[model samples]
Target: MIVITAPTGNIGRHLLPLLLESAPAHDEEVRVVVRDPARLPGAVRARVEVITGSHGDAGVVDRAFEGADAVFWLVPPDASLNPKDAYCGFTRPAAKALAAHGVGHVVGVSALGRGTPLADRAGLVTASLAMDDLIADTGVAYRALANPSFFENLLEDADSIREKGVFTDAADADRRAPLVAVADIAAVAAGLLLERSWTGRDSVPVLGPQDLSPNDLARIMTEQLGHPVRYERQAPDELYTTLVGYGLNEAFARGVVDMKRAKDEGLDTGVARTADTASRITFEQWCAQTLKPAVLS
Candidate 1:
């Protein structure tokens, strides 16, 4: 049996069908922990066992993990809360349940920056890595999907790009870094959850096809959307204030700034992509397929 958390989320929504498609062949049972079972599609609700509650709740996770062999774990972002409390706090209960239930494999969505020189200073990344440590300490077989900035993040700026032909960020406009498509992330997670041969704890870096700077991204967006889009680099302080304006707590806002600064300082450049780690989607392909439609809508 495999238990999945955040079944209605971006990755989890895509992951559910993939897992279900493969489950019958493998003779696996699939279950999910959701805050609202109503948010799940009728097909999904009909197929998997649904436990209605946040997975962060100890009781919810404990009940969901019963008779489960593997699990897909992801802490859905809550910017208004403290980063540490949101990430590590959310994982602790699941960790306990994993050990208690003897669930052998756990695939978690985590960020990339583990061995970088400034990892300790990278706020959000640091918290995510710490969460991985907490889960690994349970001695369950763990694979933390160490992803870089997501290509899907670009969609958040789609409206701004459509209206003003500009997007802003704290990172330097010329700094190139890895970016992965969330679909590819889901694909990797689904594959890992389906197979039980691997053991022990490890990090799987799901880097995109190649590195691209914000300027490169803007150029691609311009071509894809048939408009001249520009990249604006905001000062770290300005970015922090803007994030606070969006209702994030001061500490979490600062973490967002720190994460961008770390990326500007080459935090994501430390890892080279291997055939197994490199995802198939390119920035251009994602822009054409995902971002362009979002902008038009």
Candidate 2:
């Protein structure tokens, strides 16, 4: 049995099929832990057992993990409090439950630069590292997919990009931060679940093809969209206030601002990656292939 949590999100939605296709011929099963079965996209809901409930719910998660050979787990941040506590608190019980259930392996989602002291003080990257440690102590074989920031985050600024021919952030103009597509992340994660070779590893950092600064993204966007898109450097306070007004909790908003500063300081860069180990997708490719269509529509 292979169980996937947050199965409706960016990674799981693309991963479930890959997992099913890779499984050995036997009494194999793929289960999806979702908040509402009815809300799942038609393709995904049709393929797996939809265990409906929050990933944070002990009973729900407990039921999802039963008799599982492997599980893919990740918790979305709560925009209502200090996100670190919420992340640790949510995963602590689930980790304990997985041990009790005797799960054989777990592939979890996390962020990059986890243990670096230079990581943003308010960033959830630190908290995710803490969760990775707790999960490992459960004695279950674990692989944390340490991913860089997503190229998909640009979608959040779609409206502004369309309206003002620009998107804004606090990142420095010259620093190129690694940005991976969710498709590649899901592909690698699904591959990890079925392979037996990488079981005991600490964490797998999925560094995408190349790093891009705000200016780089803007140029890619402008070229791909056939428009004069530009990058605007917003003040940290303005960024936080804007995010808060958009309903993000103040702490989460501030954390993001701090992270942008960290990115500017080059804290978001990771060690060099070999092409064979991870699939690499560039920012221009991501924009031309993914973002342009969404923006034009």
lDDT for model 2, please: 0.80
List, residue by residue over 1-297, the lDDT tens digit for candidate 1: 999999889898889999999999999989999998999999889999999999999999999998999999999867877889879988889889989999889999998889889899998988999999999999989999999999888778888998999998888888888998988999999999998789999999999999999999999989989989999889999888888998899999888888889988988888888898899998989988989889999
Whole-model Cα lDDT per candidate?
0.90, 0.80
Cα RMSD to the true fold for all candidates? 1.0, 1.9
Give a tens-digit lDDT track for model 2, residues 1-297: 889998778887778777767764545688888887886768767768878888788898889888888889888888786767668888877887899899988898987776566654737776777788888889888888888788889998888888889887787776787778898889888877777466564778787887778898888888888889998888888988888999988888777777666666666675566674346677888888878877878
Q: List the residue pairs that clash in candidate 1.
A: none
How big is the positional error of residue 203 in model 2, measured in Å on the Cα after superposition?
1.6
Report how far off residue 44 is in candidate 1 (Å).
1.4
lDDT of 1: 0.90
